[model samples]
Target: MEKQILDFSLVPLGLCLLLAYHIWLLHRIIKHPTSTILGINGVNRQVWVRTMMEDVSKNGILAVQTLRNNIMASTVLASTAIMLSSVLSIIMANSKARPSEIVLGAESELGFWIKFLSILVCFLMAFLFNIQCIRYYSHASMLINVPVKKMSSSHLRAEYVKRTVNRGSCFWSLGLRAFYFSLPLFFWLFGPIPMFLCCVVLVFMLYFLDVTFDYGGVVDEEEEW
Candidate 1:
C-alpha cells in the first residue's frame, strides 16, 4: 500500500526525528573545541563580520558570499514555490463539477492549474531548503581557524559565557532547519493557531541565534574569504 499525506503517523514521526537530530547536533557543537563549528579566532578579530562568517562555517568575505549564493537559491525556489501555491489556491477557488461534459470538456482549467501549482511548489521549496543548509554549515566553518595566543582570563571566560547563550540558537536554528525538510502542509492553514505558533517560534529561534553570537567574537585576521 502506498502512503498518503493524509495518513496521521507520518507527520509526527517526521517532526520527532527532526527534533531529535537538532538536539543531538547542538550537543556536539557545544562540546566542540571552538564551541562553534567554524574556526574563527575570537582574540583579535573584528566582531560583526567574524560572527557572520562563523555562523556559516565560513570566514570573512566567504560567509557573505555563501549567504549571497543561498539568498539567490532561496529567492528562485521560494518565488517559484509561492507562485505554485498561489496557482493552487486559484484552482480550488474555481472548481465546478461538469459530469455531463465529455473528453476535452471534462477537466476544468481551474482544477488542472491548481494541481500543477501545488506540485510545482513542492519542487521549489525542496530546492530552496537544500541551499539554506549551506548557510549554517558555512557559519560553522568560521570557527575553524582561531589563532590561540594568550588572551586575558576575562576574555576566555567570556567565551564560555557566549557558548551558553549560543546553545539557544542551536535549538532555534535546528528548528528552522526542520522547516527545510518538513512537508509543506498547505491544509494546515485552516488551523490558524498552530501555524501561527510555529512561525512565531521559528522567528524567535533565528533571532536568538543571531543575537547570541553577534557580539561574542570575531574570526582571525588572517582568515578571509
Candidate 2:
C-alpha cells in the first residue's frame, strides 16, 4: 500500500532542473567561443583552448555512455531505498495487524512494491540519459564535421581553427567527473545542510591546486583511436 510521501513531488522538480541545466550547457557549448575570455579582475590574458571539436565529440560519446551507466547504478540505488522505505511504511500502515499478519503478508508486499518502484525510476532515468546521449553526440559530430572558424587559436589545425563554437566532448567528460563525485549521493544523505558551506572548503582546495600551475607541454602525437 502506498502512503502519502512528500519525496514523490520532488522527483519532477529535480528532473526538470537537471534537464534545464544540461540544456543550457549544451547551448552554451554549441554557441560560445572555444576559449572564453574570463574578465577575472583585470589580468585577463588569453588562455589556451584545449580539445577542438573532434576531441569534444569523442567526449560527448563517452558522456552518453556514462549516462547509460549511471542509469543502471541509480536504478539499483533507488530501488533499494524505495523498497526498504516502502516496507517500513507498510509496517507502520498496518499497526493494528498482529505480529504474524505483519510477518506473513505485509513485509512481502512492501518488498515487491519497492522493487517495482526501483525498476520504474531506473527506466525513466535510463531513457533520459539515452536521449541526451544521442542528442549530444549528434550535435558534437555535426559540429566537428562543419567547416567554420569558431576561435582564433593558432595552435589548432587550419581546418579546426577556422571553426569556433562547435560541439566538443570535453564538456561531457567534465560532466562525468562531476557526476563521479556525486555517485551514490552521499552528500545528500549525510552531508551539510547547505551546499555552499561544504563547497567553500572544496573551492579553496581547488583554487590552491589551480594556483600551483603544474603542467607538461602539450604532446601533439596522433592519438591511437
Candidate 3:
C-alpha cells in the first residue's frame, strides 16, 4: 500500500511538472523568438535559406551538403530510437522477472507493464519525429536550390523553403526532447522518488540549455549570412 501510494502520488506529479515546463518553454518560444535556442535557430535557418536561394549556382552544392548532414543526423537518431524500441518490446514479451524484485508500484505486473510501455512510447515518438525530420530535410534540400525569383508564387517562394527547413529542425528538436524525457521514465522503473528527482534535475538542465540570455554574443552579427 505504501509503494502504491508513492507511485500514485509521485508519477503524476513528475509528469505534470515536465509537461508544465514544456508549455512554459513553448510560450516563451512564441512570444520571444530571440530568447530561446529554438527560436534563434529558426531565424538563422531562414537567413541561410534566403542566402542559398540568392545564388543557387554557387551555393547549390553547399546547401545540399548541409542538408545531407542534417538528414544523416536524423537517420542516426531514428535508427537508434527504433532499435531501442525493438529491444524493449522483446524484453517485455520475454520477461519473467519478479515484480517484487524490480518494480515498486501497486500491482507488480501492472506497474511493470506501465513502466515498459512508457519507455517504449518515448522511443517510438523519438523515432517518428526523426523520420519527420528526415522527410522535411530531404524536401528542403531540393527546394533550397530553386532560384527565388523563379518561384514567384507565394507557396513556392523562399519562405516555403525556410519553413520546411525550420520544420525539420523543429522535428529534430522534438525527437531529442523525447529522448531526454526517456531518462526520467527509465529512472521510474527503480522508484517514484528517483523519477521525480530526475525530472526536477532534467528540467533545470534543459532550462539552461534551451534558453539563452546572450543571443548576440552567441551569434556574431558581423558574420554575413
What are the models' TM-scores?
0.32, 0.27, 0.90
> lDDT per residue, candidate 2, 30-50, as tens digits?
333221211110011111123
Off by over 4 Å in 2: 1-4, 35-225
Poorly placed runs, candidate 3 (over 4 Å)? 95-107, 148-150, 154-156, 216-225
Write one digit per residue (lDDT tens) for candidate 3, span 1-225: 787788889989999999999999998777676778887877788788878887889999999999999999999999999999999998788757675565554266877788989999999999999999999999998887776566558445777788888889999999999999999999998889999999999999999998997674244442211
lDDT of 1 at 161: 32
The number of the candidate with the highest TM-score is 3
Which 10-residue span in candidate 3 carries the lowest summed lDDT?
Answer: 216-225
Per-model lDDT: 0.41, 0.36, 0.86
lDDT (Cα, 0-100) at 46 in candidate 1 = 30
Q: CA shift at 135, candidate 3, in angstroms?
A: 0.2
Q: How does candidate 1 fare on TM-score? A: 0.32
